[model samples]
Target: MQLDSQLDSETGNELLRQAWVQFSGAESYTDYCQYWLELMCTRIGGVTMATLVLDSGENGFLPSAIWPEKSQPDEEFTALIEEGIEEASGLVHSLASGSYGVAFPIRLDDELAGVVALSLNVPHIVLPEVMEQIQWGSAWIELLVRRQRGKEQTEQFDRLSGAVDLLAAVLSEARFQPSALRFVNELAAAYGCDRVSFGLTKSRQTEVTALSHSAQFGKKMNLIRRLSGVMDEAILQRGVISYNAAATDESQLVMREHAQFSQSGGNANILTIPLHSGDDYFGAVTLERPVGQAFDEQEQGRICSIVALSSEVLRNKQNQDSSWYQHLYRSTKTQLQRLFGAGYLGRKLILTSIALVCLFFTFATGTYRVAADSVLEGEVRRAVVAPFEGYLDDAQVKAGDRVSAGQEMSRLDDRDLTLEKLGYLSEGAKLQRQYEEAVANRDRAEAKILQAQLEQNLAQLNLIESQLQRTRLKAPFDGLVVSGDLSQRLGSAVEQGEVLFEVAPLERYRVILWIDEHRMADIDNGQQGRLILNSLPEQSFAFSVSQVTPVTEARDGGNYFRVEAQLQDISPGLRPGMEGVGKVEIDDRRLIWIWSYPLIQWVKLKLWSWIP
Candidate 1:
């Protein structure tokens, strides 16, 4: 019997612990109170419980939420609620239905929050421990209400900050129309509103830009017209208009349109804010929430601030997206007004600076030069070639190497030629001995044939000797080896008449200027120019145009004409293939013309083509 009693006590303690835990985690005050009543009925053998929160607006307690929502409060428990509410302190009352009841005055620092009433189904079961536990649970009622209120306030702040940040971010990234659409959708979701719509006023008429929960909505829809009508009312009043919900202070204008719309739309709260920049009323935004959750003063202020911030962005973006001609005309008119009329000092200073620059360019004069790409080349280029088909025996020089008149550039093997020469000589000697023997034997015909054979053999020997002597390649003049590199190939075979190296004389050089085809018409044979080599950038070399090739070459996406020029001063160190910029002196002209010629020419060509 003692063990059974101890077990029951442990079970009851555990039940109370769970009940306290559930009470602390409630999301809202009404939800927590309703949940607590249900917990008491099941755990403490209560017949029924009721939760009533005082409605400050009506000056009485009203039921917010009830658990086992279908359950009705017994008359006995209901009767005690009014008595409990009247008392500023806790009350425990018993009814004639053999039901014992208890009530607690839930307070947060002396302010009554609500009343929690519970009645025991079995009066005899209301032990001292049971009553104490019920009171223990009631202690959390004030704390739960405070926690929920603070959490909601915190959430409100977070939502406000997030809405502003999102507005700035999306507006800065997108143009007018898209930014407005995105802003309305995000704003509605943040404030827990059922619908959000944005409208812009142009020509004294409001046009809907976007509506939340709908991507492509028509402005002529009945619902849109109603929503837009609300915004129009707000704009006419030049202040915020709210309906189906309490405002901080009511505006003088009547909200008849909103009343009709809300009645048809099922008890929705609507707040419309008109946006303005200076004298221009740009647009407005309408936020709509359901009956239970209405727009309060704090949210109204937030919406107004957000609309004010976003109005400038939308206005500027609309101006930017105007037609090009309209923009130009408006800008010209504004500028004319500013120049003749009063304007900011900064604008006047900028205009003055621009005018001064224009005057300077129009009247200034200086020498103008038509520039082109140029490369240095030898006046006379010499090519070294193989005398005959032979294997390369040795190479002593490559490209860019200096060589004297008699210096060996490369050599071909002479062993094969020497062997052929020896064989021819041996044949000739044998033929001569045969011819002498024929003459001693008085054989004139045979002697003559042998003599001709010997002559043929001697000629063959001469040919081979010539070939062997030509195998050693030597420079013909004192000059640098401009091109060719055979150092990597020692025993490679070369074909006859093949070019092996190119040598340019040290004393003379020419410049090849690749002038653009368009500027080539201005170039003549005698035009003088100066070249500054990329390697020798410190000095410029003067040259006279010697020749202009009639051929046109296309390279690097442009047509070029090859114009050759002879250098007036030749440097020994100046090698062929040295490239630089060459500027040909054209006749003098105005500084503006020289600077604007390319642009003017381009415009002329475009106009000529377009006119045709």
Candidate 2:
């Protein structure tokens, strides 16, 4: 606390450099404050005495360092310090001892930290210079305050990070005992403790459950009993407890058990933290170390935070370890509370709305229909075939074209038939003349033979003429050209009996529904239905099911049964091969049943297949 009385420019500068080196190297807050006060007194000179007053947070402004060892602050100097702190600025006032007192505030970021008050023996004219020097020197104090605060903040951040990491490790374990063990072990390693133990409140008494660095321990061990006693002390106090063999008591908490345990366990320092979740205090954690290693306020706070965060996770694992019936009972109780609870009005309203909707669907009845893809088809389809082996000479129509009965669809080449007919005629004329000559000359056998030849030739000519008449292909009825494209095959060779055109009657139409085999049971003869064509989506036609084919046909990645339904009403716009959808009404069923029956059936089938 002794300071040099130097005021010359060179001396002051040299002292300032020395003071800065000491201030920067001081190890603790009190040491640094002492250095700052000594430096200030030395640089300003004629300082009778000076005291560095620093902010002690909850304790208010308190004297940290006094210049000139063994000197204490009198009433006048203390009043100056209070006034300067109150005004948050530099202040100068006269003391009753006829000396002038100066107070300068040390501020960090516009907030007053403390005031440095001095009783100086200087001329009135030099007072302004003193104030200037005091103000200038306070910058170092402010910088030190900021550095210390930043260091504290960094330490707090590191503690928070470590607590978060330990909580994650605790949650990662799948059981209560293991998670608790991990927590205690990790906390011991992180905080440099010799041993850490956790205990839970069971049957209104605390019992040691987990121990650091030990997987298992007997319940009857004296150490476990002592640890449990320490935890119980903390739990009963309902707060953190710290015990130091070297320090005096700071609080009126009951520390009898802590003292007993420490005395028997190598005179160790002990810290016990209560574990609470929400409003219930359920457990405690105790950490121990050798003498001189007492837990500070910051360490206690960090350990409490870690315990608070991981408590619920441990409780959940404990609950999961219970019997199945207990789990079920808890689950049922929670659901019942949600259903009939006072809070959660929004949830209650939502659940009520859902229940009303489900109720309506469960009891309401509606028409149940089976839907399938359908196509328009004629009742009877007729095909036109070539009569004789010939080459196609002309084709006038193709598929999807409407034609009347007897309409010429295609014609075959007839030049060979015409030439064969001419040869037959010439031979018949020759046979006739030969027969007349035989009859006139009295040759009966020869005349009869000539007559037979003439008849045979006439029959052959008639057959040739009949063959020529069938060379032109014609439609059998007024219908749509269902499957023919002879316009592109003109002049191609055709064999006899080769079908060249297929025609379906336009007025008599039927619907061909390709129902999935899974829905085949819903279809039967005489079931009324409605059809919607893809081309005419705005309109619907009524129909009645006529037949359901027993055989299944595979198409479009599934097996389907062909269902034929007679059209009750017809439109001229409808044509064969027009595709549409058909829905056949089965019966009136509940709306839920109508919607969910298919899914239920599919699930049943899957289960049946999986069973055996």
Candidate 3:
């Protein structure tokens, strides 16, 4: 062999022994690969060498060692090493810096395990023995990769076993809150985490429920808020968030919050996993670690797998905690077990009664009415507005006053108009005297000027008279004053076009039903309905739908369509602006559906939104 021709048998044998010892003694694959690189540079003449290995941990090929111990290869030389791996036979050529370059592909079974490169500062053919020497050295590299793979498999098995135990311990408890607390604490200990926090969403906000190593925490604490903010980021994004954890693979989140938090006091590495069941987001859990011990892809993946298994427990427990209905259901179930359980006589009676009621409700037919809040109004509402800007002299009518057409509802102060009219009258009389004087002198130009001034004076007098007439506001139609009452302020300044009163005829009243948007689809014009006013609850007023306004208005935190229905029989006591509950009959429906159709529709909408 070429190695035999170059080196004596004893020296070659000694070097091979040293290479094996280094491979076994070194703590990491990087160190083991470097040992061979140093050996080749010292033993082989005129060469600067490097050893590289495919690190699955990094998802890339990494230079295990580059000599002269400080220098790194340029991009071109690195590219050559990559190219050499694809070749059937290795290549040797002169480099840009006048040195010969050789790259050898190291293979394990069928896979190109790594590449070894050398730069020789001489013009010489690369010997077969040198390639053979590397062939021998590559065995140690293969061993390193094999040992690492085995160690990883063992670590993964251990992580999975611990995860199963962690989940089982929490699942043993029937209650969710305690189980969640146990989950965080046990997880912190199992993974050597500095802190682990679990949170559940309440009223659209995620609140931290349990903290590792602490049973209780302040809700308003800044630290908790900061932690919640981190979890919230993950929940809103609908994904996992990690920061400063691993260099090999990066998380998809920006993780700016983590960076700021990490800089606050201690280790900044954070992992947030959002827990969800179907479309409903339950909350999230955050794990923190100190500096120099960030979680990598493998550790993060292990956490994800464990969190996915325990998420349902957290969801169910939190739901029970936040919902009083769930608590009531559970209590009733417990009580029924005690009274109507196995051999109790009451149990049989209750079951029979329930069965009979269910049968009746299922088969019986009834009128189904869609109920909404209604307000009484005139068939035609007329607004009394100020004809022009003026001070209020008097408000004779307040709300609920009966008035006839042309009746004075309110009067603006006409004193300003009367004084201005007297001034205009004086100007008109003076201009008329000037016109007579000019006509007598026969000064044609002076007479024409006087005529123009007289016309201007007449125009001013007419405008003032019009203003005085408009000062008193009179109703256009006979109606009851429904909304406005300006009796207390005798001289309140009023702006032009300002409405002073709303009038509607008492005998011709309309009902404005504020129907919820959810039930809008069932309503149309001419639908018959009945109303019961809050003031007079004993009597039911019949009405028919006249128009369903297309516009939606917000009231009491829900969108409602204003439906106007004319009262069929207007009562003398029934007044505009009076409100009560109104129900419109949609159609005849089963008794059970008549009572439960709203809930059924709500469920249908929710299912359609989330499914598929």
Candidate 4:
């Protein structure tokens, strides 16, 4: 007996777990109600004939789902449901046939949504406990109704938003082919369709217009022909045709072409909706998805709504994008309608205002300018050279440092020169003494030779002293150090005339403009322009073209010409290698020409090259 009881307990727990899963995961209200009713009757141990009655809007209170599948509700069951609705509460009634019935009214959002009724056949069951259990279980049904309604409302809102997006995407394009292509592609992506094709009716026959994800298609292609046939089938029926490969039973509508097309596309599920504008059907749109992802009733209705909303807009675009003569005819017809048709006074006023504004702008004139990349460079760059071959002893300044005209930039070692000077001075002193001796002895030849040696020694001493003075290199003028850094190599030897530091004057600067080779014709030496440097963008400097270098430099996959310009006024922060943009002003021209010249030039070049 103990083992049996344990087994029974486990079985009941398993059943409860399953019931919760099914109840929470129910997709529709009917499924939820049916599952809930079964669980309630089984757990409460109640009786024969249980039914779930819900409000059916126009049909009044009716049974949404029934328990025991085949069981019929007796007259007493009907009475209990009516009584529950009337009293707006739970009811326990004694039936005329001696059985007892319990009814629980379910209220959602404080309004009576439905009622659940059960008939108890066992007389020994506690009536109050059964009534309480029924009432408690009604809450699950209420929750199910709320969740189902919320899901439905969310789906509706999403469909409405998608429709608006589709319409906007189609209407944004001005030409008919582009608009139709956009419409089909949007529909395909929004619905998860593999292919979406649109076709228009001409002379009672259908011609495929635009296909999703394809820019062009040949009419002689087999797939296009099949798609055209499918569209024509929908148009002939003048209604929606939906075909599922899994469904075996054929409906009343003829779908021979749809079946063939589906077979060709790996048994894809197809849905085609005939498109109508005003009172006539003029086109059709066919959507195809995978076999398992069949279009449901709600999805089909949403797609139909989207197609209907965009049909008229696509039609207008198509008419406007016809051949030249047809476009002219339609444009003339539209203008005539606006001029003479009733209730178009607002449109006429808007058209007139737009025309007047366009006329005024056509006559306006504006300055034309050619823009080019420019960089600032000093007028003259001066290089500070090493005066003699010597080792660098000390470095006081490097690149980018401002120096005076005679500032000591670097120093070379003068120890060797100092030693040489001492040797020369001692030799000169000895030679002088020898000359004095020769004079004292009255030796004319010795005196003359000693005097010559003394003079030669003096000249050597003078040369050594001069070499010592030039050891300290100095800046030639007041300017910024443009290049050369020697702080890292203080003891390194330098050759004679080797440049050490380059300095440029701060007061004079030139702008080197890199103009495209194509635009060199428009630029001249005297044209005036303004420059804005990248480093100092807040200030603008006026400049004039000085010279144009005829040499072409290939850079960044384009040929550019180097043009030199002179800055009219020097700024405080101007430095070499400051890059900026320069715009050279040309003569005044019409506003239309200023805006359309580039396009016209490109077209002319293309035409000239293409002509044989």
Please give the CA lDDT of all the candidate structures.
0.78, 0.87, 0.82, 0.87
Error of 4 at 275 (Å): 16
Error of 3 at 521 (Å): 2.0
Model 2 per-residue lDDT tens digits across residues 1-612: 123444456677888899878977889988988988888888888899999889988999988899986698888887888898899887888888888999888887778899989999988899999989888988878888888889889978877888789989998898889998998899999989999888888876888889899999999899988888888888888878888988998888989899999888634688888888744678888888887788888788788777777777887787888899989987897688778966778889999999999999999999999999999989999989999889999988988889999998888899999999999988888888898899999999999899888888888988988888788788888988988787777888888889888999989999999999888888889999999999999999999999888877899899999889999989988988899899999999999999999899999999999997
Which residue pairs show collisions in model 2? none
Q: How close is candidate 2 to the true structure, as a TM-score?
A: 0.57
TM-score of 3: 0.41
TM-score against truth, every candidate:
0.46, 0.57, 0.41, 0.47
Task: Identify the superior model by lDDT, candidate 1 or candidate 4.
Answer: 4
Candidate 1 segments whose C-alpha is farther than 4 A from its true place: 1-345, 431-451
Kindly list the per-residue Cα lDDT of model 3 for residues 373-473, writing each as its tens digit. 99987888899998898899988999889999999988999997899999989988998998999999998999999999989989998998888888988
TM-score order, best first, reads 2, 4, 1, 3
TM-score of 4: 0.47
Q: Stretches of candidate 4 above 4 Å error?
A: 1-361
Q: What is the lDDT of residue 397 in candidate 1?
A: 95
Compose the digit string of candidate 1's lDDT tens values, residues 349-461.
Answer: 89899999999999988778889988888888899899999999988999988999878999998999988888888888888889999999999999889988988887888
Best by TM-score: 2
The better candidate by lDDT, 3 or 4, is: 4
List runs of model 3 lying over 4 Å from the truth. 1-353, 437-448, 554-557, 609-612
What residue pairs clash in candidate 1, if any at all?
none
